[model samples]
Target: MLHRSLPIRASLLLAALCLSTPAWSADPIHKETVALTAGKAAHSVKGQIKGYATAEYTLTGKAGQTLSVKLKTNQPSNYFNIRQAGQDEALFIGSTSGNTYQATLPADGEYTVQVYLMRNAARRNAVANYRLEMGLRD
Candidate 1:
């Protein structure tokens, strides 16, 4: 009787294990760094220019997983915009005096960030260089 009961217990344990979610199956965290450079041609006829110092990053995660993004700019601008891939929309657009920006992602996928300089001609001439620090948060 004891031996016969051992087989039933083993079968039950196997079933439970099969039904359990796999810990390793969860999506892995990803990150990448990108450099941006703007030249004189990027400026307008009046020498006023506003463009992005962009960075490209690939994100991989489960369908329902949440993604967080943070960005640090070299300098504050009059306005800025954040664009995502496959969506004809802007994630964020507004004025910022601070150098850092943050946002929560809607889904799991690859995203591209473009940090534009919103300074006017006078401000543009004041800036000859800039840097953007971008990252993803789990």
Candidate 2:
């Protein structure tokens, strides 16, 4: 009887551990496309994000081209992350507390920029209305 109870306890512990994790751990990520013209382009997008919601934008350019990104949010705790398309990890772009990112593409393909609210802020049931500006230089 004691051995049977041990297994039940372990199952409850595992369930608790999973529930305590952050919502962003598996939130749906929405995607958008950025259009470039004449080897250069700039765009501004506006939207609202609630809780742990995430959004991503994709653009294609040649290798060695420069990309500039800026995010302005109504909430101070919102920021953006840049990563290569088809990848799951974000690139380390200096301090992770800013709304701006700049880098050169390592290869010629689609790159993704992710916008999300900070974890601490998201937990408080916060919402952010933001504008994302992007520029690509050829």
Candidate 3:
């Protein structure tokens, strides 16, 4: 009876060894960049997003990659409305005031980052001078 039980224990150990082997892991995506110029507008820049807005030059990303977005502005105005592929993700909004705005991208795909002036009682159409930076992480 002991000899028969010995074979059963050996088989269980062998099965556990096979299951313990590690599987392959996928690689992480690399960092990328996009640029935006002045003089691009949507319907209007009111409470939602008003006045002239500009978007990034490129919007290509890898699968399963984390995208870190940063927006640097010169002056403190209503510089808001940074979207991912024409969607209102809002990376930065509601008065950053000559500062940098940051956000993270969820998935790998084509994403568009936009910046615009906020339209309110002040109602001034000033030229937008800004820069965008994107990075990747695990």
By TM-score, the best candidate is: 2
TM-score for each model: 0.40, 0.72, 0.44
- Candidate 2 RMSD to the correct structure: 5.0
Clash totals, every prediction: 0, 0, 7
Output the better candidate (1/2) by lDDT. 2
Looking at candidate 3, the ten consecutive residues that score lowest on lDDT are 38-47
Q: Candidate 1: TM-score? A: 0.40
Worst 10 residues of 2 by lDDT: 88-97
List candidate 3 stretches off by more than 4 Å. Answer: 1-51, 86-104
TM-score of 3: 0.44
lDDT scores for all predictions?
A: 0.44, 0.79, 0.47
TM-score ranking from best candidate downward: 2, 3, 1
Alpha-carbon RMSD to native, per candidate = 19.7, 5.0, 18.2
Residues 1-138, model 3: lDDT tens digits: 999999999999999977774444322222334432222221121122223433433456554545554556554553534445655555445365333433455555566544555545225545455555555544
lDDT of 1 by residue, 45-126 (tens): 1112233222234334323333333434344552335555678976665354344455556765555544345545223433
Instruction: Give candidate 1's error at residue 17 in angstroms.
Output: 74
Q: Give candidate 2 regions above 4 Å deviation.
A: 1-26, 38-41, 86-89, 92-97
Model 2, 31-138: lDDT tens per residue?
A: 898886524547889988887888888877778888888888889888888877666777634236477777787778888777888878878969989999888886
